[model samples]
Target: MFSAPQHAVAVACLTSVIAVAPVPMRSAFAQSQFTDVSSNWAQPFIDTLAQKNIISGFPDGSFRPDQPVTRAQFAAIVRQAFKSPATRLSRPFKDVSYAYWASPAIDYAYTTGFLSGYTNGSFQPDQEIPKVQALVAIASGLKIQPVGSVDSTLLRFYDAAQIPNYAKPGVAAATQRNIPVNYPNAATLNPNQQATRADIAAYIYQALVSQGRLAPIGSNFPASQYIVQGGSLPATPSEAGTGTLAVGTELPVQLEGAEPGANLVMTVGENVETTFVVAEDVVNTRQQVVIPEGSKIVGRFQPFEVNKTLGTQFTASKLMIGNTPYTVNASSVPIAARKKSSLSIADLTGSITTLAASAALDSAISGNVRFGSLVPGIIQTGQTIGKQVIGKSDTSDEVILVEPDLMGLKLNADFEFLPGSTTAFVDPNSANLYQVDSGTKVDLAAQTDNARYVMVPGETVPVELKTGRSIYNRQNEVLVPEGSLIRGQIVPMTVNGKEGAQFVANEIVIGTQTYPITAASAGISPSSLQSLSPADFQGNVIASPEASQSLRGVSSTGEQQSGGLLGLGSLIGGSGSGKKVILFNPTSVQMEFRAPLSLNNFNN
Candidate 1:
């Protein structure tokens, strides 16, 4: 939906070009002007910003990323990058006249709190801006105020002493805002270095991320690696708290679907996963967010302290913030506080509650349930049994019956995200089972037999691995020896009753692991099968690619002989016709796992 606007790059602040290579699939320039920066550590930043229309590159196809940015140029860029309303009256700068090309830009930046003038009653617009100065400008404009002591956070930088006193707070705020992009070495702030195109691009990109306009780049990227941490974040009375929640902090939550007048009601006792959405952001005294609105709280319904009222407790086990989840000790007051429902537990869980759920839910909700069709697909969440128990992003919200003001979910213990919480969190299964990334090339075989195997449409046939393979990482180091004994099935499809066949794959197996795979082979028209006349080999075995066929002649020993199995097969095609036309198999098959298949402990 985004259209890239053509822009010309100029040199200096006015020059719009900055080149940052991408992490692939990321490019805006038809021919990259940042070609010189393919090896420049900041290309990811450049790629992101330039693509977002925040930066431009030279017309001659060069982005001098290392080029120093003058104060005036920075002001110009800032004026165009940040969207903010003016907060103060504009005043004349002694050094810049109204007619100066950068004059309006300087005033806009100054009014937006992104730039300031020297005390000598002059805006030295042409002076080269320093690293700290630029970061401060962005932090101030976005109204980010750091929490705790700025000095302590700044100490993480090796050049702590070199930071100008006035710029310290701004730099600290920027750090907490995650705006500093130090390359090669994270500890080196280089605060006094003249701001460069690359540096500014990274800062602006990071600022956007803090505002949630841009998703945070993963920590593995070079540009993301230098993002300074250890800075005290603000307990913004404007945003929430210190992005922390206290032991007793209560988050305002409601069953996700409770709209204006009606409440989502659920029958409890079945400990299926129930989800709650933060009704509003939970903020601290300073108004910094502890839990943001729309975050998920996955919980379970448990017996309420063994109460006879059948009031169940929703025990919060995990808090999903952004893409990460944290275990929490929290529980809500009784939801189904007064229900001994006539509905059976089977009435709630799906097949685990499908048909019955829809009827029972409607009956329970409005005293009657609707049945659009006795078949399937019309089964919907809140309407269908199996789906109503869990809260999904695409599904409508579900809430347990509870008083609006009384539904307080209280945290039993202090919850805080530690430094590098997101980055340090590892997938428990990252190294589990050796992984052959998607698109891994595999060689396989189907057992050859004397029996002529003929499969009609929708029929399945087994296939197996033929050779061993090794998988390697990007570093070319062997990740795992090729897993062996891979197995799966080949499915046959009639080519539109055209006397042709296309044998597509349904799944492939590796070792003892079964993975769902999808595949389709090129159509094999009858013309391709014209070579096979029944008289030539009445007793000879014939089958589709899934079954060992004549394309690879089988030896008398019954072992699959070597040859191209895809070269027009002798089996497949059934239209209630006992009369067999020379069997045809598709010429080729393309397959990939529906989900990534990673398994280990195999005999190669």
Candidate 2:
């Protein structure tokens, strides 16, 4: 697989690409616990490489990332890092012998088009490898050819004159391939500088990225600003280094339909699927939303154990960020719930939990036992219980429902954004020229023509839009245009111990197109309900006791009206009659979306 002609050119290049000073890397291997990386700028890069065994710390437990690396050690590193087959004939060198520690690696590197021996037939393995030589080795081994003129590509770095004549093409190819990582300032290539351990690690990582062996690093990485894209600097400052969605980014996620610090009940060992929406926007340095609110984190809420005590935790498997779906490694804190013997169905939070727990405690429970006792999770029924309890008549604290709180989850693995994911959102000249930021609410006048529809919990009513409106940004760009109807549900809730309903818009329809929407209204109740006279509600809210029952069990599609009932809808409260029922239309209702909306052919 060796190329004879290219091998001749490579031998000429490596001999001239040399520097004076050299450092020895001879040491025993140890996992990374570098003594001096606490404040190093390249700590993130070094840590990752060390963890993967691409590089290692010295025997004394010091990485000394800034120290220079010699040619022989670099050869060993190349062997450890890459696995390509030899494509060029290997020639015997006078300086390296079969007994040499790096002799095999030297042979592999030369045969793979990575390194070359001197014209005198001697390979100076102890010479410090220069940055240009290291970069050329990676580019050549990977067969990275410059897209355009090599001279123009090299000009991005201020010290273009410092690059040697023969190595220019390979160095330019490496820059084009994003293998050159200039620290402090990307404009200076520092071609003749000695290659440090940190420098080699970063170069190899970027090479892996170019080969698609690793995910693209975040644009905001310091070294990435120097990466020449298509042979030039990024067109815009934002493109130079966008926001970093780093590993361990704590995403503040809100459980759908659940309040903060709210208690969620589940059984131990019981697995259930649930979704949580992002509570806020994860913005970049440019204030553009990366992961907007309402992005769903769907996962399994299953059993966990901590300190030998049973608990529950959420292990996320799928992350739905806008239109993109990603498999993720993330989870929430485990919560240990109170153990119990039995539980009532009505006391549960989700629908999956229905069976009684610890059925052996039936004798301890009287017929039609009250909810004084509660238990969490799926409890195997028909099992015997042997509890050493001191004579206590009241079982209120024994068998009862347990509530676990789900605040937010954390990313367990590093996540990188793919290129062009946000390019359209930031490009003004692009087809998608407008963006409606998160928390952007629109005041939509009801489109009712003197007819009202009554809606209750568990039912969705189609609220017609009037003339509607055209939403605009501060720059006077129209984001969303008029002509849309809101299909919403009257979500039942308890506000300050009083029954109320919140209008949650689930979808919006414009002409024949339907788009999913997350919008809501300030809940309305008898105590806080605002009354709009028949004339006041031009054609807003429509209500009927009969239609409310018909709309039950239906979500997006169904008739909003069973017959003509042109008036305001009544909010029925309390079961089997009691307090009072009132007819009202909630004022200050807004159709603001809970997530980011891009007008460029917006989809889910």
Candidate 3:
């Protein structure tokens, strides 16, 4: 059996080694002087081990706490802390040579049953050990055993999915022995992350403490709570009672009335009826079911004010839980529907002229406050007129009618109530319970390329989801599924006299229902660089066509035209007339979710 050196002798040997070792080989300070470990979670452990001379900082006076520990370094430390009787019949690893600096330590570690070579008979001493491997090695050396089911004990960790099958037993034993010290959130056991120097120090110190070789420190570090003698196993909340579901529990419901190709108009006070179903189950901290899956939610659209300067707002009102009609003070959060107008050179010049002329007329008409304010109103009216004449033809009038399917969308619960409870207190902060955040990319394909079809603002265009994706939280639970329907609208805008299309995602449709979502991405195909020719800007406009077929639109007059809006004129120069041009080529679209969505609102 491996044995640690007696405390007094170990301290003496460490002191003597420090005295005899060259200055460059010793730590810059006699105590904890590691610059890098000062604020580290494992600083205490590192300091204790450093003072004992079992571990040392770098020559630069810095302890790289997060740096991965190599097998050789670990072996050296193990040899310093522990000692075992050598067996006469012991054999050295084929790869470990006598001349190697770590040869002695490796031999000692192997003979002490603390380490072993690979099946191929090579020690690979320089290899960086994984956290799991390090823990397993320490557990095996100390002969620790699990007190309960290994799998059950591991489930206590938030990142249990990262634990490897082979390391389960060793990890369970380590946890039971209270030898594993996790930093930051003790609930998160990052088993797959590389074992760092700080991690090793903590593991070793805990191991020594468990073996009655060292006294425990009284630090409130998160890892301290897991020490066996210091504390008992963490208490898990009982799963017996029914937990309360917070009042602002959001149900991801799909819209049943809104369908593709439905003619819709933007008008204040418009009422659109929609039916929805809960997407996921709502469970509280006690793991008790609160809102069961498949609960139906009914809602209707209310007045949405459209402000030319600020943006448009859509609100849902009269929300009710199906037949049961649970009291809910739920209202659809006002979604920002901003419109971008495509401005051509003529439109910009005209608007400027109208405003200038209106200002001059207003100045001549009156110089007082009442008339002064009238100048702005007149300018605004002129600008509106200018847009009516110049912006209409240049920009598409298409708009996407939003009818969200919330069948599979995920939402967080904020109110507290029992399962099957009829009344739920609504929280005002829950207004944004269903907003799918930005940076979420969903694969979308437009029915027709901008080259073949003109998408006007406010016009609904058909888009098919091409790929499926899942959204997860830090706990790795699937909150949203792949291939869910996404609703988007073409936002037209002019930049530097150039017209462009910006697609803004509005909602996600799942299982015949819709939920409000906000996502955006550059409309370029993800694989466009690899699949298209560098010289051809419109290669991704259509399906793979022959080179000759793509070139058919290029005329001898250098006028290259596609079925879309601006064609090649925008690329090379708009017919040399100095007029702004727009390109209407169909482009690939991807959406990425921006917020952390809770899966408890949806059912599996």
Candidate 4:
């Protein structure tokens, strides 16, 4: 696999004839010429290759470290790095014509087993190659063989599920040969990310070192250690440095000096920044210290849309533990108004009674009913209505406020720490600190009766979790407890000529933390007979002889009316009868959780 420096020089000379004029060709003497690569992690590898004439920089004296490396550019590098004779006959690729700039390099790479065209008989030479694909190609070209189990070796650098099927063998072989060079974090091998020009330089140089063609650099860089023989996997960022806290790591904190009714006002569509100190030392299941006590957690309330009915919803967007910024996918937290009040059933009944009494007086003046009898009946109906209203309004009259104090709020997700000496790298996959399964059940009580009045679409109402019940996972661990607050929105629906609202749960608030939850079941207890109708009022008014004759006259004419003026009185003047519409909350309500909730690292 090793090639003499003179061989690279010769290859560079040949390829320069067809090289792009914009990128100036560098001579073997012009090493470390790229200005942009001075501080790059791949600088050492780039300098070494440039000195050997195996790589060159652009005319502007820049390496363009992060620029993607196309397949054609990779082929040119392969031709200059490997001097072995072709083992197989070369065939023209459909996409690479004889006039193509890199056609010669492509043919040489294919015949020497460094690369292969796709099954479609086309070589997409201009396409950017993925990191794993580039690693596999270099390993194959150098005939590297795995010294250990392929599965186990690849798992050391990446999650098993992340390894692609086609690149498995090649990646395994590369790992054993110690030819893979990962910058930033050694443990994270971003297999599918596009390979950069800097990345290619590191891979080629490492391949050369593995074959004993180049001496390994005595550097403490993470990538350098992987190339040294028998070097222990570079210490995880945690062990080697001060340790970095991964994004999505939950930081449980307490409100330093907050009172029960403290108000935190946040406007919709604006960012609110705040800071809280860590309440306790947070450690993961791996015993890694993610955050230490007194550590500062910086956070900002992201811009959000306020639902006129649901109040203002705020979600945490920018969060930083120490100096590392995290992408937070947390649930929107609803802020409560400073002062709120609810209507009582007694109050509602009183208003209805006053209206009914006035209607009754009007009926008597219009000669619609006997004055003396109807007046006595109206008085009795009012007394009966008061008793029924009392039974329906058995709920607490307390107003609830939503105020989450972050000072002592425990983290709802795991906090993973991987510290480095100066800069820390976070594991992208580990950012999802909490996992909630599907089909979990949660029981809730309606805060306001959706059936109290005709509900309109887009209306938001409050609900609470019923007492004495807890939401549990399959392991019987409680996720949410009774008395938690939930917000529901009304979705208007009409069926069989009956119109009502379908309550959809938009969020659940536990303590100060809020999570989005879907409601699977919503039901309300049926109203009592007395609440549904003014039966006593109808009995007294319709049983009189005069009322009986009026009913018979309508009945004899085939109009089929009943209860005489009593039915008309109930329809026109009764507070509790005549097409009664129960639109808001019922006497009792139950709501079930539609999504699974996990409290893996949740603390009470």
Candidate 5:
């Protein structure tokens, strides 16, 4: 195994702080110092500001680092150091009682749009600050913006997704601005974990430096030659685009069709309902027979119950997917309510595919929540049972169901060209499910070109593109076919007096090839760029990503009885011995359907 290098030593040897301007150092005087403000970690912060008289020890000669800092105390310190020029306060939160100690600071932070309150109006002032919350506050105190979309993909820590919602945006913003020096990976925000005094000092100091209020610390590293001056950085050529591919989403089409050596390959459609199981019991009034073997088990519900005791198994149950055979295992529950019960179709658990096929049978026999209203006709005393109505009822009891609908189409076009051929053209209107409407072509440039064009439309040749951003690429160069899965922020651009919306591509997968563009490229505010580090790369080498299940739709109806039959008279009478030959009567079963819908595709 490769040994890991020490981070502290690596930072010390490889990186050095840089500054835009030289800052003069100053020291605090006797009267300006606090006598009691003392803490192991607070000293570094106090010492750094002591020269400028920004902070001092308290009269008690103690900093009380472990003690939680009240909102009022923090506000006072912030006001004293970075006084806002705002003339009035905006009381945004309902719970910041006027008597609260940090009322002024809270009010100031609100008016400056640096802080917001929760749904319930209360700012528990004494609560210890969380790592992410503190980072946000520090970044807000000193403005910061990240240079590019910061991907937290590499963050391998467990519970990475546990970052609270309230602090995610702020934490991301701070990370982008590089105000928090502790972040070793993009995925691990470690928000809501307690903050230490030493950590607080480091955060504040880094925030100050990022805001252009402080000078570079000691130590010097060679200036990077790759640094580019102001204005948009010159684009570097990348062979392939980078981005995420969402499930049920369509992406860009590569000039080369998907093949064995293709750059990308699709694993399988997921989140699709593939498995299902029939619910058990409910056969008799008091003690009912449980059927051990149930109807068609589905793959979708496979995760529900593995080899555990399924309480009362079903019998004579069949698992089917269209015409394919489905494998199902059965077990019994020791409950003695119904001495010996037989399992029914409803007792089986299975995949969505199997459930769709057996929907009619299930609805007729199994009283599902969706089909409970249509009770089966009962066989009362020796004659006719429930009357069959002919005319339609006054109320709209007749329900109509629409089956799962899908739209898919492909297009092939041929254009004569040579090996260095570069071209840019709008997609022609076609009959395919995905089509493009009219839009501005101003900032729209070429995404892929002659760099790796080894084949023409109809000719076969090997092709390879370098991976990175390209010079010809624009913020609007990306194109998404209508009905394709798309997400991220929409950047507004005005071209020729017409305001148009530009969707920065976040995740795109055309056919089998996948590409994940940064949210920033999708036009989302850099401040909103959530952790998306390369370490977060979740897709296999064959595809962009993978999901656990899939969805399907089917229709069904079934019948049930309360159990009360008395037709013994007509049985011994004429040649018709109606001694209940068919113990279980059949009922009209109507099938229903359902489908899995993804939010990525706007048209779908």
Candidate 6:
């Protein structure tokens, strides 16, 4: 492990040849100078040392550039250069063969704490010096400590993982100190294998110069121009440091904010950057995200909540069915709340691109659905009861569903908001309006409180209203037509008076169309209905004709009252539908109201 640095020390000892050779043969010295070395790629330190005759090639005339250095040889060279007193030898290892030439060198290195033998007592002097181990020894020998923290986060070398674990800490210390040129490609740091003679020479020479004991090594060299002045490792690399993947890749908006995810940002160039989220990890290799070099990408997400225990439901207050509008009132309309159900995202917005709703919701909800009710509305059956009353009832006073304010559901998605897609509703929370097909309707009856109302761009709550009264069946029993009851989120309501009283749901929000609940066929359970007086049913339970027959067995005298069901058609008046009405009121009207008027007067 320590032989490579010892070889460097040996090369340093060879420095004596520089002074003696120049005097003996100027021709030989010039021939051996830095310019004479044909390895044009050699760094400045190697060039300087070659000129000094401190390191040389074999008689075969080929400098085995990849060969490993040995301990005894290195020890001899270091002794020559430093001229330090030798320490007393102690036979620490059992395997030191009687004729082993490195015994003395190994003894010196061990005594000085520059190297240590294996625990088994063998000094494998012939072993190649691993890159990391070599770096540690060099730092130890030179007593160098680079500035800044040893941030593995800054390393982007291709061979980062190849660095031996034992040498990492020392190498990191050396890197910060700027003593060793550990990486040549900026992309690779081959920690193990062999330490070439040229590499060893370069390291030793630089250490000498950094210590102010030797002159600067590479002064007048062509390659010197490419050296980044005052170059330092980055605090955060543009890519994922060390690993195979080139990081800082961006993804599309597959989910809304209510998702669980992480965003990673890296610096590509000075101020040039990109971002990615952990959500992209699922399809990373195949689905590579490509973005412009300088553009910033964001991860949009949508997440879902899964309950391991039991299923649940929630009721949302505001619901949009296509273009129609609907409201969930505790007094009038009721909604189902669900606990756990698979979620699929049909759309997404406000991100770099688009992502799948399932992907988004996975992390968006994760372990906690406390905030899940923000986007979906679902409720349990038999959860609400509609009260039956007689006279016109006021629904103004009642507390409906209670929910927490959620920021948004987060997902692993790529989504970008189209310009002007966000709009504000009566509630100040701005909602992202979705242009979906009008015919589609989704039944979300198994979501939790966190999913009741979704916090879209403009919508603040997690629970959004669904079309019609959200009916919930607790025992798996089908409540045919009349049996399908509408229970208010707050007070219970039922049909009253001769003809069943007209019940209007707060909203009928389908996929993209939203209409008011006005059809006479729509009825509420006397217990589930809100605001209606019990007497309003007049013995007639509002139900489909088929349901009426099935209820004959359970019919009460109140529901069988005959004449009590007449003249009830006018209760809701004519076409109690969703009417868009605009009014202009003036204290004084000087002219009659006219349609399609063309004003001829010009502005004064």
1 versus 4: better TM-score goes to? 1
Best by TM-score: 1
lDDT of 6 by residue, 309-422 (tens): 111111122222223222212111211222222221221111111122122332343223323443432211111112111112212211112111121212111121111222
**Cα deviation of 302 in candidate 5 (Å)?**
81
Q: What are the per-residue Cα lDDT tens digits for candidate 3 across 1-604?
A: 0112111112332131111111112222334478787667677677777766677776577878888887887887777765444433456787888877777778877877777889988999878887888888887665555654688878778888899888898888777546777766667778878888888888888776544345555545434664433122322222211233432245555433322222122222223343444554555432344445555554443333332221222222223333333333233333323122221222212122223223333333322223433323222323311111111111222221232332122222123332344243232246433333323455554443332223322222323332345555455654465555555444343222233444445455555444444344443211211232324454333321222222333312444444231234333322232322222343334554432221224543
Q: Cα miss at 255, model 2 (Å)?
A: 1.3
Residue 579 displacement (Å), model 1:
50
What would the C-alpha RMSD of candidate 4 be, to one decimal place?
30.2
Q: Where is model 3 more than 4 Å wrong at Cα?
A: 1-31, 84-89, 221-604
What TM-score fits each model?
0.42, 0.36, 0.34, 0.34, 0.29, 0.31
* Candidate 4, residue 477: how far the Cα is off, in Å: 86
Any idea how many clashes model 4 has?
21
lDDT of 3: 0.46
**On residues 80-149, what C-alpha lDDT tens digit does candidate 5 reach at each position?**
3453434345655666677655666677665654555666776665566666777677556544332333
List runs of model 6 lying over 4 Å from the truth: 1-36, 50-53, 60-62, 71-91, 152-158, 182-184, 219-604
Q: Candidate 4 regions off by >4 Å?
A: 1-31, 220-604
Q: Say which candidate scores most in lDDT.
A: 2
Candidate 1 TM-score, true structure as reference: 0.42
Query: lDDT (0-100) at residue 92 of candidate 3?
Result: 70
Clashes of 5: 114
